[model samples]
Target: MEQELKAHLKKLMASGDVAGIIALKSERGMAKPYLFADASELECLCLTPKYPMASVARLLLDEDGAARFAIVCRGCDERALRELAKRHQVDLDRLVIVGIPCDEEMARECACPEPFPSVVAVGTKLEQWEAEDIGAAYRAMELDEKLAFWKHQLEKCNKCYGCRNACPMCFCKDCELENALWVKHGRLPPEFPIYHMIRAFHLAGKCIACGECQRACPSDIPLMVLNTLLREDMEELFGYVSGTGADAENPLYTKEEMQ
Candidate 1:
């Protein structure tokens, strides 16, 4: 896939299909976004330790077509970009996607249901990861046991907002978490279940299950498992999938859409 990716980069660069490729460049010991124009730099492109590459591209591209580029997208990145575009965060027409499908190992590591983007330019698109509903097991326990289990997990939260920070879909100029009235600032744990419930309800049909929140958590919380369940609930309720299309109805607009 590396060789194929390099070849595609070269082709894109030579044909002036993009201004530059927004991809991960290994620097020192970190893999972060860098504009890769020269095909030689594709050798240093790192696939592991994924960042929200789509967000990087969103910030780089202009809203009025002032800049154009091709991005190296995984399934999550591609889906996130689609979602962002729907929200007017990015201009999709000005960008091209050079998709790199995750192999089995990376797919399993991310625990992603859709490991491959719609555009399969390079690499083999492995089957979706079969994720376990860890929440379901907790739900099956007795009421008291379930309460205790959630209390224990919720107690560990330091109110860092790492989950919101890592989430690509969480783009709001004014967030409820930041409001002193809703969340009461300067309080750790932030009222436990309500604190977490606010985020859970907000992300129901919006989260793409990228696992970025879990990665960013210092406390090693399995936030993605909770998000997966939310996604499932949304699908069951409204029959919608996040980032599937620009015109796709979101659960947030359910009332308006039903009119």
Candidate 2:
């Protein structure tokens, strides 16, 4: 399957299906985004230590929309790209998805519900994941306990923008978090529940459970608890799952929500 992917990428590059292929290349022993133009460069491609290649796609497409490009997408990357397209952050028409199914270990590490992309171009799909009771257990807590949990977690925040920067869905040019009025500039803790709540609410209809935000947090905050709760809320209120489909409408943005 590894050879199959290498051959496929070579074909895509040679045949001009993609002017450039956005894939990971080995650099300093780390896998990072590298644009493939030559078939010989395909030898450098690697996919481990997963970075958000879709986020890289978002940036590249902005610069060269007319050029065709292909990206190596895991399930999370594909879904993130779909949601980004919904916001006009990415032009899907100019891109190709070379989907790669994640292994079971990666699936559990990500806590991903859907670990397989809609299509797979390389590797056999892993069907099972070890489900975590993160959301359900947190939901089972008493109101006071829940409050304490959040307060404790949020107390560790240093006001770094790691979470937002890592998120592929969070594409605001001028973030409200930067505005002194919303997040305030008083102290180390920032604005506490309000600061985090604003971000949580903003991600209501957009978060795809990729766990990038959680991974980027320096404070080891259980941000996934907040996201998983919101995911549940979105599903219950509108039967909406973020990144489920490219064409699915975000109810939060619908005109009817205003009324």
lDDT of each: 0.81, 0.87
By TM-score, the best candidate is 2
Q: Per-residue lDDT for 245 in model 1?
A: 76
Give candidate 1's whole-model lDDT. Answer: 0.81
Instruction: Compute the lDDT of residue 51 as modeled in candidate 2.
Output: 82
Candidate 2 ranges beyond 4 A from true positions: 257-259
Q: After superposition, which runs of candidate 1 have C-alpha atoms over 4 Å from their true positions? A: 62-65, 127-129, 254-259
Candidate 2 per-residue lDDT over residues 36-127, each given as its tens digit: 88888888888888788889999998888499899999998998999999998998998899999888888888888788799998888986
TM-score of each: 0.90, 0.96
Q: Give per-residue CA lDDT, model 1, range 1-259, as digits (tens).
A: 7777878788989897777888888888888888887777788877667788887887787443666788889999999999888878888887898888877776777778788899899977865467545557755689898678678888888889898988888888789988877888888877878877888888887788788888888877677767888887777777888969778968675566542
lDDT of 2 at 164: 92
Candidate 1, residue 153: lDDT: 83
